[model samples]
Target: MDKYKQYFLKNIRKKLEEWETVPSISHNEVYRFLHSIAGTASIIGFDEIGSKARKLMNQLNETDDKQWTIEEVKQYLFEIIEWFDENKKDAPVSFTDKGNKYGDKPVILLIDDDTSFLMYMKEQLEKVGWYVAAIANPQKAITSFYDVRPDCVVIDIHMKETDGFAVLEFLKEKLKQQFIPTIMVSVDSSKAVRIKSYEMGADDFIQKPFDLDEFIVRVKRQLERKKHIDEMLLLDELTHVYNRKYLKQAYALLQSDWQRSQEPFCLAVLDLDHFKQVNDRYGHLVGDVVLREFARFLKQGTRVSDIIVRFGGEEFVILFPKTRREEASEVVNRLREQFECHSFREGGTAFSRTFSCGVVEITDANEPLEHWLRLADNALYEAKENGRNRVVSATPSQEAVHQKIIKIAVVDDDPIMRTIITDIVTKLPCERKTKHELQTFKDGVEFIASNWHREHSPCLVILDGVMPKMDGLEVLQWIRQQKRSDRYKVIMLTSRRSENDIARALELGADDYITKPFKLLELEARICQMMKRMS
Candidate 1:
């Protein structure tokens, strides 16, 4: 045994001898001596000495000092001192305090009845960049959970006040949403003890006399697991952008910032042009590559403060805090141009794709998120109708700009088709008309039911054929049957298989037709032609 261990044992033996000589020892003195022996013996791995000391303390608790006989007390003390003499285990080297190694180190809450062991562990852990709060009482450890918010907890399973399982349950209950990883250490190595600890929310269990290196590794592992789990919840696995869940959380935080300053921020929704066709043409694996590259470009193009989220599939949403609508428009339009110019290659074959965006500014905190999203969606739809590869502003310019607002309607049964055409329309530029009004519908019946003819009649209608109720043909026939069929300008969208349908619609007075999967630029050219003819 080390000299310090031998010295401690001799001091304990001296105290016991003093008790033997006294006619009757007080309960307080018995407790003081037994508690010291229990703490020191446990630290030095003298298990029998620690257990015997605890039993003597328990005996002291059961009766007052007047009831105890001198013979009985001396007999108990003799066994404890003799056991310590026979045990030959050396005390581990005491941990030396190395002051403040880390600036913001992880906090560890260590709870044990043994004060000596608690102090030793605290010193060792502090040397390895851990801020340990050592609590000798289990009751105090339970109450400290809120204050510490520790990264990890180390508890001795056999505590005087309460067991480690009770402490684990208390911590788990208090930390409902997140928890501090707990390690329960005990001299008992039975299977039942480990199983009960795990069932009670213990992250790990260590037998007494554990290697310091192994203990540190287990603590580090739990901390790493917590970090990785947090990241997984916030990040998109495929695109590495923030997912929708994170976006919602960020919005709540940003909303608080907006409430303080009332500063305007822009929300933009982006959709790639003909993304479905890309997947169909080059398989889903190539489609994944395209989406990843697209997200990378978005991140590279935007400012660091901007929040980019892969909303779902090929659609994404960007939030530009403390930016005006016009500034956001300029930023996104520049990116849109870059996207148009870049080529995506797969298997030695090159393909190009473009995305359209709708930008809206939130100037009022009273406006709900859903309303803002709707306005952005409307602008995006208009971009698709006018032309793809463009940016449109939902926040209209000041009236002093003298910009005429164009009204356009898209009637398509296919939701994806509606989104595509709206994105195209949003890109249309009218230096004369700075903002455009756009509406979309699933079927022709709903469009006609709106009775848009009188006050806010659309200047152009991009109608889809082969709809469920009231197809594009029926809508055209209804328009022709009216008194002024020429008053409405219509561009029909049809598939290659619907050539006969297009012919019939043309004879029925449809203005023009574009085949499905048509080039976005081609659609823009046809819109220009229709505008010229109408003028």
Candidate 2:
């Protein structure tokens, strides 16, 4: 024990035990006492004690004078006090704090059937500050990749459950869209394997039994490149606000949060009034300056929670998350007034320009983005008609925008898998022209028994191959025999080593086949692609 150990233990023990005998303590007092211990214990070399003290301190709710009973205090600090009693005789063996477990490190999805190698690689990666999601079964590659959303993927070429090629093939679409780095690994460093892997959309290739440092360097290199690509893909070049591509995605996520929490959010369309006049009088270069200054003004003027995007020339969109329509409208009005007062100087031409804004609260979770845009656009047109520099809040229409609602059926016996797919579907970037309707069934019989298949609207069925009381193949056959012409798109989810079943599924009119333990992004991409095909 350090010379300070006795002093530390005497003070910590007395402070903690005081809670047990005292009738109560103020929340602020308890917080201050824990803070004192946390700060002092670590400095004196009782690191664990300090760490634990901080954890207990975090549990305290801040208040001016709220009282906490002994029971409530003990609930949080029992471990801290107990540690002091047990460790009075000995200090915790000198230790190192290896950071919070996988704290914000780049996540890597590693697929290898070799358990020993997987464990070793995972340990090595974690040691170097990489979070590795290692899966032995290739079947789980799909599900884990989708759920984990790893920054990189390292997959072994050889596996009994499913080969690395199949995983790569399914993940190809996602890799193209996201540019997620994928590394193919194998004992064979043959040229053919390397070529084949690259052809399958593998971003990098590594031979097994290679130097660990080299492997990490290669993975890090790809991650660096991906970061650059991500920045380029997400932001507008001139305005530096989010681009149009990002708006649809952000809107979908906002809708998802609204559906879950019912928290209010508003969508607004903003156009600089008479922007063309500025561009014509001044050159395009001057026009660029006005746009950049406008974006800067909006960013500086609005709350950080609001999202500003350059929705294409002179047109900008802002998402006021967690703000009601009335409040957002007021904010937009304030911004409009503030912007009108600002002057843009292009070579001593000091001219002031005003903007027109149309804002609407997102009321319907099911409304397509265009519906919201149209509502805001109509209001924007009204603002232009009324006056150039003004803000307008659109009245909610009772009539809902109608689109083809494609039934997305997940017929899986496993409830967990069903829930995962259903959840992921909410995040899928579907074609704006069509909205999706999701349904889940336990077995093939249950799915077929329902009138979903008989619905007049186009339907996409994600049918599982194996199920009790009528399997996926049987369901596929029944779907094919239906009187409705190819309005139905079915993606068969088959188990591993189902070659005959795969062939049979295709023969029975399955639109696509994905082996089980599928990657999530692949499934989402497949669904999105098949949806396009159906349209």
Most accurate candidate by TM-score? 2
TM-score of each model, in listed order: 0.34, 0.35
lDDT of 1 by residue, 1-535 (tens): 2554556656765666676677777665566566556544543445567677767765666234453456766676777756755653554454322233212467677877775576467658866766666666676566445445567888898988788878777666434335457788999989999999888878899999999999999999998887676666777766889987787777777788999998989899998998967866886557778988999999999999999999876889999999999999999999998899899888898989999998999888566776677678778877887888888898543112323344567887655456556766777555322455688988899988876653533357788775655778998788768765545777787644444675576556555566544444545655554443332
| Tens digit per residue, CA lDDT, model 2, 1-535 | 2545565666666767776688888777777666556544654466677788777766666445788898877776778768877987775543333343213457678887776676568658866766566666676466435445667888889888788999888777666655789999999989999999988889888887899999989999998998888777888767788999899899988999999998879999999988867866885557778989999999998988789999877889999988899999999999988888999898876999999988988877588888888788878877888976888888876134434478888998655457657876777665533678889998988887898657777888988776657878888888878876356778887644456776576445555566544445545655665665554
Q: Which stretches of candidate 1 lie over 4 Å from their true place?
A: 1-232, 396-535
Deviation in Å, model 2, residue 268 alpha carbon: 6.0
Model 2, poorest ten-residue lDDT window?
A: 94-103
Task: Report lDDT (CA) for all predictions.
Answer: 0.70, 0.75
What does each candidate score in C-alpha RMSD?
Answer: 33.3, 22.2
How many backbone overlaps does candidate 2 show?
6
On lDDT, the leading prediction is: 2
